[model samples]
Target chain A: MEPIVAYSLVLSAVLFTMGVLAVLARRNPIIMFMGIELMLNAANLAFIAFSRHLDKLDGQVIALIFMAVAAAEVAIGLAIIVSIYRYRRDVDVDAVNVLRG
Target chain B: MNVIELIVFIAAAALALVGAAGMVMSRNPVHSALFLIANFFALAVIFLLLSAPVLAALQVLVYAGAIMVLFLFIIFFFVQPGQKHLYVYSLPWQTFFSGILVIVLICILVLGLYMGGVFTAEEHVQSAAMKVEELTSPQALGSALFSRYLLPFELTSLLLLAAMLGAVVLARKEGRGDMEEKD
Candidate 1:
C-alpha cells in the first residue's frame, strides 16, 4: 500500500508548517534556533521521501549530512545566543543589532 | 493494516506535532529544548518506517541523545534569565507567509492521495527503497553505510566531534588555560 508514503508526505508537510510557524512566532533567540532546526528536519524528511521515490539511497545520505550540519549549527547558534545574552542581559532577537547587516 | 506500524506511525506523527507546538508555545527556554528533543525522537520513528535503519539509529543517537543533551546542559548553566524573561513573536509578514505555505502543502498532500498510484519494486524509488521485509533490514543498511558510503560516514562522525569541541569552546568564557572556569 502507498499509505505509509502518503502518511510520510503528510507528516513532512505538517512538520514543515510547524517549522514555519515556530520561526514566525518565536521571539527568544534560543527558540528561534529551535525553529531553524525544525525547518532543517522538514527538509530531511523530504529528502528521504524523494530518495524512496527515486529508488535510491542518495537522499538518505544527504539527510544524514544535513542532520550533522544541523547539530553544528545549533551548537554554534546557542553559544552565540548565550554570549549575546551575557553582554546585553536579554535574548530578544528583534532588539539586538550588534551583528546585523 | 497491521497494528504495530500503524500505531507507531500515528504516535510518531503526534509526537512530532505536539513537540513542535510545545517548542513554540513554551515561555521557558528549558521547555523549548525539551520539546525539541521529543521532536527528534519522533523523527527517528519516521525514519525507521522509511527503512533506513542507519538514519533511524543516528536520529536517536545524534539528535535526541547527544546534541539535545548539550542544549539542555547549556540552558541549565547559562540561561538563568530564561525563567523570568519576556517572550516576543515573529513579524507580521512571517505569519502571513507561513499561513500561505500551510495551505499549499495541504493541497499537495490531497492531490498525492487522490492520484492512487500503484507500488512495485521497480517503480520509481517510492516505497521500494525501504520495503522493510526485503530491502531495509538493519544488516542491509549497515553494510551499505560501511561499504559504499564509508568515507562520508567517517567524515560525518568527524564533523560531529568538531561540533562538540566548538560548543565547549563557545560556551566557556575563558579563551585558553582557564577554559573550565566560568565568569
Candidate 2:
C-alpha cells in the first residue's frame, strides 16, 4: 500500500479504538453518542481510502450512505435523550434503570 | 509521494488523533463535542487527500456543520446550570475491559495490515498508477448514486422522514403528559 493509505488506515484504527473507549467508559448519553459518531467517521475514512486504493466509486457512495444513516441516528438518539432527561432529570445511562427488574 | 503531500497527510493525521484523544479524555461534554468537530474537519482533509472531494465536502457540511450543532444544542439543553458532576466514570471494570479490548483490536488491525501486504513497496507503484478520472469527481459520484444506487438513495430519504417524525413524537412534551394522565 501507499504511505497515505497506510497512514489513513492506522489513523482510522486508532480513532475507532478511542471511540470504543469513550462509549464504554463514559456514562453521559451525549458523549457516548459522540463516540458512536467517531466510530462511524473512522469507518468512512477507511472506506474512502480503500475506494481510492481500488480506483472505484462504490466506496465513496457507501460513505455517503453512512453519513445519511448517522444523521438519522443522531436525530432519533438525541430526541430519546431529551425525553429521558425530561422524566429522569439526568442523562446518565446507569441512573435511568426503569426497565430493571 | 511527494514531500508536500506527505507533510499534509502527517499534519492532518496528527490533528485527527489529537481530536479523537481529546474527545475521549475531556470531562466537559461541550469540549468533547468541539474536539469531535475538529476531528471531523481533519478527517475531511484526509478525505480530500484520498481524492474524494465529494466525501470531504459532505463530511464538513453534514458531520461538522449539522451533527455537531445538534450535539451542542442537546448538550446545552439537557445540562443544567451549576451542575458540577457532569461526567462521572463510575465503571472502572468496564473501562479496564474496554482498554484490553482496544489493545487487542489494535494488535489485530496492525497484524492484518502487515500480513495483507499493505506495507509492501510493490503495491505502492500500482496504487500510484490508479485511474483518477472516474472516481474523483462529484459528477461521477452523482451518476453512480442516482443510477446504480437508486434504491438505497430513495430508501435513505424514507429513513430520514421516519427519523424526523420519531424525533418529533419522542420530544413532544404534551404527548408525554397525555400518556401520564391516561396512566
lDDT of candidate 1 over A14-88, digit per residue (tens):
777777777765666667777888888878987786665555677887787888888888778877777776666
How much native contact recovery, as a fraction, does model 1 achieve?
Answer: 0.45
Cα lDDT, model 1, residue B36: 87
Misplaced by over 4 Å in model 1 are: B1-3, B81-134, B154-169, B172-183
* Cα error, candidate 2, residue A46 (Å): 0.6
Worst 10-residue lDDT window, candidate 1 chain B: B118-127
- Enumerate the chain B TM-scores of all models: 0.65, 0.87
Clashing pairs in 1: A52-B125, A52-B126, A53-B125, A53-B126, A54-B125, A55-B125
Cα error of candidate 1 at position A48, Å: 2.7
Candidate 2 docking quality: incorrect, acceptable, medium or high: medium
**Model 1 chain A — which ten-residue stretch has the worst lDDT?**
A1-10
DockQ of each: 0.47, 0.72
